[model samples]
Target chain A: MREPRFHEVEGRSLAYWGLAALLAAIVAAGLTAAYFMEHIGHIITGMTNQIVWGVPHVVAVFLIVSASGVLNVASIASVFGKAPYKLLARLSALLAIALLIGGLSILVLDLGHPDRLIVAMTHYNFTSIFAWNIFLYLGFIAVSAAYLLVMMERRLNSYSRPVGMVAFLWRLVLTTGTGSIFGFLVSREAYDEAILAPLFVAMSFSFGLAIFIIVLMAAYRWTQRPLGGAILERLRNLLGVFAAGVLYFLLVYHVTKLYEAKHRGFEYFILGTGGIYTLLFWIGAIFLGGMVPIFLFYLARYRHSRAAIGAGALAIILGGLALIYDTIIGAQAYPLTIFPGMQVSSSFYDGVVNAYTPSLPECALGLGGVALTLLIVVSAVRLFRILPENLADIAFDLDPHEIGATPNRGALWAPADGR
Target chain B: MTRRKAKRELDAGRRRFLGMAAIASFALAPGVRLIGSAQSSSPASARANSKVRWGLLIDTNKCSETCQACVSACASYNGWKNEGRPTDPQWIRKVAIRDSETGLARTLPVLCQHCAEPACVEVCPTGASFRRADGIVLVDRHICIGCRYCMMACPFKARSFVHQNLTDQRPQAPRGIGTVEGCTMCVPRIDAGKVPACVEACAREGRGAMTFGDLNDRNSAIRRNIAAYSTTRFRADLDLDPSVQYQGL
Candidate 1:
């Protein structure tokens, strides 16, 4: 093996600076809102006895599903043995770790007492899906972080194949567990279906792939490099496949609910009620989120353009958000009972029955979570030097001998790289 | 094939038949006795027996919306202060239920069902909640670990947990923070040979919505009323064989 010269890249571009500024603004707003929620208590939020969980939960689940997408690069390299994804592994792993932390932070802040979160871990109810989710989420964060470490460490790099495999398998189980939290409620009548778990898995792939593509494109731009035409085409093809899978799962999920008619009230809330939420599901999720992205990716010339790929990625991310929001909101939209010949009105919210509006504080905490995610990603990139200057160089690194020539091998261990 | 072998085989078959006979007798004995006793008992003895187990029959139709007298009386008798919140200590709660298809609403007052086979008792790890010999489910707060598992196990949602600290809680029902509680059918009143506070309150209100009597007493007011009018238990799918019955929904 020959020694390779160190290439000192210049500071971040204007685009990076702009993104950082926006992220900081979001974080500041979110933190200020969170401080009020904490000091004033949940009374400040729109949440009441009826609608206990609102936009905060919606945003949390959105980030969680998006975080699931971080596993795609590792999954392709370890599970499917795709060589082109090898160089992007560490970067994807770091993003996955950061996203989970962001998701958890939002969830913890949403709780009645941020201090009592340890109780959620210590007080285990084996039967309650919510209790089980606490454990599963912790496991996901640990495994993703461990895999990231293994990817970045020179000594542990050889163990990447096994570590990556475990990380991939764990995410699939974790996402399924997330789905089961809703699906296993046979008594709820609203969520008594087997398809939710599998649907969640499909969603994890779609959202995961979308985030990966966007981040990879940005990383390429930051390094003043370009991804190979063939590699970009391949990624676009995979995104198309994922979009189709998500669409199929979503269609079957809703159709089955309609067929059962057990949860007709909730079903009607999503489809029959013509409102912002309905528009979000039909237009944002089904069309732009699902169909348009697939169509763009399938077209060769469109898929090759970086801007077009970014647009498709954005559409998918927005669609994933819409899908999760629909799931959480749709379930609680109707009153719990619809017994024949019973006229019961809600006592909580006056006049407009079954209402929900996320308070300003809730919105603030959600934006804060996004800011935290970007900060983690930016800081990790600065310390780890995971981005490739060019796609051709990335292809070269895929070979075992060429990896030895990469510079600053010792810098991978520095504490500043902490995600 | 041999004489000894034949003897052993005969004994084994005899034991097997005996075991089967025992199971068959066990299954048939309750139904047979129920019918047999129905024929044998005289009307007068069935009406006035003190040894018979007391139960309540509530006519939900006659229950007025303003008739929270039962809840009030139960709370007062038990010495439970009304904080007027759902999370507070509530011995009895009135759940407003509406029919999904017809959209008709009715308020059903619910307390501990005092089940023959109580799920809360079964799932209680500390044995804090237990069913008495007479079939009343009672919680020993002294032994309660405050796990709240019983609250989750209850299908009717009858149990409430004390979430706040209070020094002024009444002595009769001096519940501390982190204890699960529900209606006790006014055991203290029952010990004094009086009807439960709720039953007395209902009777005083003149609607006669509640009738308390010994269920084992075949000719008691509750048994007779149940025989004359149709009654139902909430969530009968649980098959808990609840002592409390409701009529005229």
Candidate 2:
């Protein structure tokens, strides 16, 4: 087999420039929104004292989780010693770092006092989970950069395994830290579950793989590179399994909450009475995010079809956002259980559902984070040799399924089993 | 070697002098002198000590639904008056509770519980939300980044995020937009040897329902009230060890 050479994308194309301009415009709009919010106050936005964290948190969390998840490709190749994924490892590391930076930008920009960010870095409250997250997030970025450097340098190739293991462990801790942000909040019924840490880890897996597939396909297709069906099959299978893992964790979270008589109100609110949250969980999270993708992975034909797999990945992304919304905003909407049995009423919206309507500015801010992440990924691929020349003849490195299976040949979704 | 040893000796002497100076000033200050006699009947002005946990005892049986002096007083004092907005900050508010089984209606003012193991202080990223030496939970606005994680962590919904900019902030409270604020138990008044404005207002309205004193002092009115009645801590199951105790739920 001839060794594959790396090539940078020709960024001079009109299509490329247009896409870049569009993403840049979105980012600019987001920055403007953040500025106005800071200049005037949070009163301009839909977020209230009641629903403290809104669209920005949901979007930021999604990006942060996906960033850690994006590194799975590199981890597979370097730590797990899967040869086929080695070609995609550099791009994975790049995306992981870029995505985290983008996520952090949105989070910091949306702060009550963005200027006081200096205080956040300077002050250390060891007991606070948020404080620990600062270290975990920054460490992940540094480790991922080192891993990428090792992958790029031929002389440093031997160090890739140890560094990759470190990066992998760092990502797990990062995602766990993110989940524990909610889990440590013993005050709220929706949070305070020990399972939340591992649940977030699983969520990172599913959301990250879904995004990786989407990016991989886009990069391969736009650059007119040969992305083989065999690689897609492997990634899609992993995505499906992680997607199933997400559902299992969700089940455990809800069941645990339901079993506790004290937490029953929270369960009822999210599952039954909570209007938008309930719909999002049922249709968006469970059905589209989990079921459809799992179905796609199970059917041999859909699994091999890039278009089908891409669609499933897109659904999972949307579903993941819905799940975050359900967790952050929905939980806040339900008033704290101050008085257990007595019917309590107050001027502070006590025992009442705090209404929230996401305005244009908040929505723009969220979209800006997404656009910023994609902008980095797109720009990186263009400036550097991040994409492989071809994966057409790459053999399956870690599985026996490749032995008897024939490759699918079609434009879109087609039967690959020679039926 | 001789020069280094002499310098080290001088440094140690300077350190000893500074520590002694600090202790001497503290002992001589009026606040520390007053704190020594804090167990007295008359109002005591003092720097708070770990041994003195200031708290309030509310006799709900004497609390009347027709009277809202405490609520209005808190609003005016904290400068958190309702601006007719859905997101208006409420530091302390009158909570009307009705028992479903007995139809027994009771009205009580709810504020920060000032828990020993405050969840807000625990979850705060910057440790801006903190418990003082006297067990008074406070948000140090200087360092608070207003992430509102403390607001989420608070079980009583006692904290409020300053959603909008303000021009006329109370000089005593010192609040601003984009930072979380809550009932401070009138820390300034407490320091000045005066009961909280709400407690005074309640008394002026001919309802001495609220009692404020040092909980650690066995002879204190607040301590005696708690011992004499079946007092309840809000959400006792959480075991936050709230300084504020309530009677007649």
Candidate 3:
């Protein structure tokens, strides 16, 4: 593989401006919602002393988890020495950074004291996982940016391998830290399991790849560049494997919870008794999020179809979001059993499930995070040479579908334009 | 009491200073001398220390189901009532518990246990939730980011996030928007050598069901009652070493 040439997308079109404007509007609404929540306090939202974290957490965690997952393509190329993925590394790194910034913005904006971010940064409680995550997330951004630089600059090419290795390790730890935020909560029955860390890693892999495929395909299609069948096939296959891996982890987590009689109530509540949670866990997270995507990828006819692959990716993304909702809101809805074998009732709503219906402000704030992610990605791509030119014709040894087909080497190479 | 003993100790040390003739004349003439002196100062002015671990013992047998003296006292003391809003902060509350099989019902006032190993303290991102040297767990609103991680980590569900802006906060217990609040075990009163407001209210109601004292003192009434009766900590299996104990579950 020769030096991969990068190109800047022509971002001055009506469609481009319109999309950017729309996303910016959504972001503005989200900011406005955050302002109201902060000004008036959390009384406007569904979150309470019982269900402390709400939709914002779901949105933020999904974005943060997916951010770490988005870098797997770069890791595969730079760390595992996959030639095909090497060309796509820059875009992956860029997406990771954009998604992280967007996710973190929602998280910070939703804070009770968004103004007190300085206080959070200045005061370091070394023992808290939340404090540790602040450093991990910031460190990931810095390291991944360096990784992108190493990939983009020919002069720094020698450092790319080591830097990529560091980024891969850091991302693993970052996702683990994210998972442990809930995992280490000893007071909650649904958490305190060791599986949550690994479960998040698996979730990141699936969610990240699904998002990467969608972005790659969209960028290629909108720019009139051929995405080719080869890379898509490999990505589709990897996505299927990751979806399966997520299912395996889910099974292990549920089984582990079920094995302990003490945790049985929680499992039953989420699996059977819990109303909306049960539906989401079964239909949204399990069936559509995991199984449907896996099936779409495995079917020979649809596996190579760009539309089917995109659909699969979209399903996974939606599923990932639902999974987060199920985990976060669902877990909180089930009342904490503070007292054993006693029917407890109090003014504080003890022993009764807490109700949370997402308000418009919460929806705005959460969706604002999504729009912010897209805005960053679109703006960044327009400003930088992140997207590879003519990805369709890159000849590689592992193109299973094109083993005997002649490589369109001369036809594929295009000069960098619109710099 | 303890203040009298401390004053006596200060006077004994002051006697050595009285050995000097000039100082002796001034010290001996109590009615005419030594204004604003430290020897007669109350022990409550002294800083809280580890030598005493303040605790509460609640006897359910003596507690009446209809009474909410402790809860009302705590709310008034903390100033957390927000027009009876569903999200209003309740530092202390009465929980009505009934056995599922036996159908035996009882009422108990629950608040922050001030655990030796508090889950809220451990999970606090900014160390805002902290246990004092004397084992009073409190949230320093100055540093609290209002992430509410402590609310999730508290086993007793004792913590409340201030959902709205607060006004006219009591000088003793200052609260605001977006900070976690909980039962402070009446630290300000405890520091002033007075029992917690809830305990005082309960006793004033002629129940005398609640006792607040230093757990480390062997002769403390709480320790004596624990020795004489079987008192149980809520969720004792967690090994939190709760300072609050209850009799008659």
Best by DockQ: 2
Lowest summed-lDDT stretch of 10 residues in model 3 chain A? A410-419
Candidates 1 and 3: which is better by TM-score? 3
Best by TM-score: 2
Reference-based lDDT, each prediction: 0.69, 0.86, 0.86
What lDDT is reached at residue A107 by model 2?
92
| Candidate 3 per-residue C-alpha lDDT over A271-386 given as tens digits, one digit per residue, 9 for 90 to 100 | 99888998899988998889899888787656446667788889998888888998888888888887788999988888998888888898899999999999989998898889
Q: Between candidates 1 and 3, which one is better according to lDDT?
A: 3
Candidate 3 accuracy as lDDT: 0.86
Compute fnat per model: 0.10, 0.82, 0.74
Stretches off by above 4 angstroms in model 1 are A1-25, A338-341, A346-353, A392-419, B1-58, B68-105, B110-246
lDDT of 1 at A316: 90
Q: In candidate 3, which residue pairs clash?
A: none
Compose the digit string of candidate 3's lDDT tens values, residues B134-211: 888988888998888888788898989899988878888888899989998888888878999999999998488899
Model 1 lDDT per residue over B1-249, tens place = 699999999999999999999999999999999999887773323333346566788887887776688888887777665555433456675556666776565665677888776767765545667776556677777666454546535545456665445566565555754456787777656655788889898889748788887778888989999899899876565577788889977
**Model 3 per-residue lDDT at A198:** 96
User: What is residue A262's positional error in candidate 3, in angstroms?
Assistant: 1.2
